[model samples]
Target: MNGPEEGRIRLTVLGGYLGSGKTTWLRHQLHEGQFARARVIVNEAAETPVDHALLGQASGLCVLAGGCVCCVAKAELISVLRKLCDERTRADAAGQRLDHIVLETSGLADPGPIVAAIKSDPVLVYHIVVSEIIVAADARHAMSQLRSEPLGRRQIEIADRIIVTKVDEAEPAELTKLLSTLVSINPAARISGAVKGVETALPSFEGVAPDALPDLNGQALKPPVAPTRLQLDDSIDWTAFTIWLSALLHARGDDIVRVKGVVRTPAGRLLLQTVRKVVQTPEILPEQDGLGEDNMIVLIGRGFTQSQLARSLRYFAGKR
Candidate 1:
């Protein structure tokens, strides 16, 4: 393979389905200094961004929320890339030069469109070279997602690297099935595994049976999944809040694909998230004074409304 041109900047597109652990994997890589001197750009579907808070290790970071870069936000992405290129051109110090750009796409985005946009854009085409597309696929839910979601299938089909995340929690047989399916769909793509963002070995699926993926007519999708932001205030009682969340997940977990929140409490800042019905243990984040986005929750799913969620939370907390 030929090396990149002298002044061109390499951009890596990290993508995956909802709750597929894209941030987790990217965080680990940044911590390990894999992408040295790289600038990170995060595109989130929710207006109130949460995932970007965890990626402080990047050399630089920019967040674009409330739009999917593949469709709704392509122009914004191009503009950002052009700005980065201009900055690189203007930098004189050796340490100030950016080695690469890591764009973390919204979970709902289609990598194909994003990739196409960069290569086809008149200005971006001259300044940037797309390095690769790294996609993270959830092991526990890959089967169902691939079978039904056209967007999910497109993400996998175009990835250069497919990371099967949450491997430790997935069933062995099902994991094998997912591996087989991924290989069947994208034979040229390299496959690997990760547990809670740490790299691991993928078991051999030499003869495992791949699930028969149904032919989704592209329009047969369920209602589009969107992010609903909810506010958490000091007036809310803790016990009632727990009950409300438990009840909400219990009733609508299938419809609610991902839940992520960063809230401030007497103890410290807590990062809480869940994928489907599985609730992950909360982790404490470093204290930051006057974090504006604190006490906010973003639920990404279909079959729900913003007012309905806010009302339910308020009712359970006895604040309404």
Candidate 2:
């Protein structure tokens, strides 16, 4: 559907491995009324959505049962998103406006395809923009899970932010190792700890910038070491950047877990992010001097060398 609407609905995809406390974190958010004006889409693998039931008294909550939204129920997800947007639009005319959308993917679900579906769909593209991918990692089991399950690693790799759940139950050293492993897998992501009954703010990516994209060259490879960050000296050609990024992600999405940055384009400052192969359409930011002029791009991945990544990004640099 085409529209002249001014505001796009912001979306956050919550995902993680099974038993990672995704539902527990979500329940906390709901009880705190953080999603008071948000339409929540709950995807469950079973015939009935237990998560939806647990979220009692939550307005605008909808369920897509019997399958994962990232795969089997993607079409239903699209339909539900459109319906939510339409309903909110009508509701706004009557005085209540929905502020955002929170999609709770089944714990075992891969969020890449769900993100792709939102960006590629003709109708949803005009209405929704994914803000971030948040994954809940169990502090006690994450390391073991990562060793055995490729899915577990992928979830960590794609996250923009990770909430380390069950922190209170984990031993100090185990928590340290888990956090370190998380950094090794996806250094671009911000890691936070969560415990039941202790309130932790629902992680948001708004106005957050990479702390230090560390250069890994000649350094002893270690867990929790920072990933390399590349800053272009000049504003990039948006078309050129898009072309390069699309090709890069298509070719190495599995290895290159998370990519996010702000860039200055002829049109404006744009926020760009991707999780694995699912690239979000760039969102325009307010025009301001020195905004994204640094052309900072942070890349987090495994197995690839720094020189290789540097070589790939070199073309995007403006002529000196």
Instruction: Return the top candidate by TM-score.
Output: 1
**Candidate with maximal lDDT:** 1
Query: What residue runs in model 1 are displaced by over 4 Å at the alpha carbon?
Result: 1-6, 92-95, 289-292
Q: How many clashing pairs per prediction, in order?
A: 0, 0
Residue pairs that clash (backbone atoms under 3 angstroms), model 1: none
lDDT per residue (tens digit) for residues 1-320 in model 2: 12444478889899997657776688888788777777778876644333453455466778776667887788888888888878878988887777689988876588888899988999888878888899999766677668655678889889999999877767766676677677778989988888852444433333443323233355564342123465654745666667778888899876665565666677766666565666756667654433122366665556666567667666654432
Candidate 1 vs. true structure, TM-score: 0.95
| Candidate 1 residue-wise lDDT, 202-272, digit = tens | 89999897888877995555898888888887666777888998899999998999999887766678888
Query: Candidate 2: global Cα-lDDT?
Result: 0.70
